[model samples]
Target: MTTIQPTHRRGATRLTDAGRDIATMLWRDTIRTARQPEMLVFAVVMGVFFLVLFNYVFGGAIGAGAEVDYLQFLVPGVFVITALQGAQQSSMGLATDLAEGVTDRFRSLPMSQVAVIAGRTLADAFRNLVGLALVALLALVMGYRFDSATGAVAAILLATAVGFGFSWLGAAIAAKVRQPDMVGMLSMFWLFPLMLASTAFAPADSMPGWLQPFATYQPISVASDAVRGLCDGALDTGDLVLAVGWTVGLLAVFAPLSIRIYTETD
Candidate 1:
């Protein structure tokens, strides 16, 4: 009984220690963001730019036949897409740390190496929330309105989940390649098609019939559709359910790949 008690105590202590380490790593990554204010500025600038570009450049033509406001439709869609682009930033940041020898110092410590990626992804998600807020604010200024409070909240939560899930891919790339620039280029390869093919910028039904199916079913489109329905006061449980599934599915698949690469890399 005494020996069993001690073993249990040790196990609990190990978990507690792991939690602390992960927390510290998360703190460190967040602090890095604080120190580099330009990253936030960059996020805001890009977000606002996209909002303006789409609302002014394309909204009129796209919304011509629609009864609802195009800006409203666009805002949520843009928000989801921006959240994804923000995920690419996470990949680049992780790659930079690996290239800079910061990862080695973390590895040398008596800590859970997985905390490095976990901390990075969490911190990026936190930053993404801020960026998402900023974009939503700009959308409001541009006269995009949300009808459903619950939907608005759900959209924001799911969008951030998408960012969190997609960032793992970036982490995996960074961990494997150890090059920030390389991460950026590689991330674009996937992000571009996934982003452009979706209903974010345009209605999926308007797309070529052959392309429509692929665009409609992809994760980004699934998430964007959920966000659109939420902002429009139309509640679609299927989209919400599917969005959750994709977010969970992405994390499930890429997390281990990221950790394994981070572990194996010198």
Candidate 2:
């Protein structure tokens, strides 16, 4: 009878103090990452590896044919990828918690369940900021220059938002599967197609005509092009609008679904 009370409380839980509850979960995630610093190091190393690989290995060949500077175009796309990687990490982290019964422990408490997903996504965003900063610093060292400081800031924010949208997708996946490894495997199926098929690595024209339509209009392509334009001072208003729309739409649809799935999950 005593255990039933908290279970019943689940349906009605709302943040009495939204700030305190969300902040507590956010801090919990932060402390957990701090205690396992290797993950951060791995993230940084992976970002660096991609930057080096693309800019040096493909820059000369790709830039000769294209009018744009390869290094400049590449940086913003990498920023989006880095941000999304952080979101992927959030998925794995949430799945681990679910597998270990940590989410059940959280459910037994009185705090707002929405705070859990919100805090998790926000913490992942913060983690991504660190990764973005590192990659940007390296880009500068490697001769990647932005056209305007304000534009650069806007591009970074857009990249973060794209990452945030995907984080909700991650949260929803974690909630549904409740297994860390499976989330990673399943996410890769879509992640690779979206990231690779889009303008992240190369121009859409370089792809097959049949595939170009999909690559040119997908969220990753729109977001990458917008970010690239912002950095390169070639701003395309339409692409930016589409990118913003995609971010808002993803959050609008997935945020509630993630919260519902999470709350209902065992």
Instruction: Name the regions of candidate 2 deviating beyond 4 angstroms.
Output: 1-16
TM-score of each prediction = 0.93, 0.90
Worst 10 residues of 1 by lDDT: 1-10
By TM-score, who's the top model here? 1
TM-score of 2: 0.90
- Writing each residue's lDDT as its tens digit, candidate 2 over 1-266 gives 34545434332244346678899989988888788787677767777877899888988888886788888778988987887777788888888877776777889996778888888888878777777878889999999999999988888888988989999999999989988899999889768898888898788998899999999999999999999999889999999999999999989999999989988743
Cα displacement (angstroms), candidate 2, residue 8, comes to 16
How well does candidate 1 match the true structure in TM-score terms? 0.93
For candidate 2, what is the lDDT? 0.85
Candidate 1 residue 178 Cα shift, in angstroms, is: 0.9
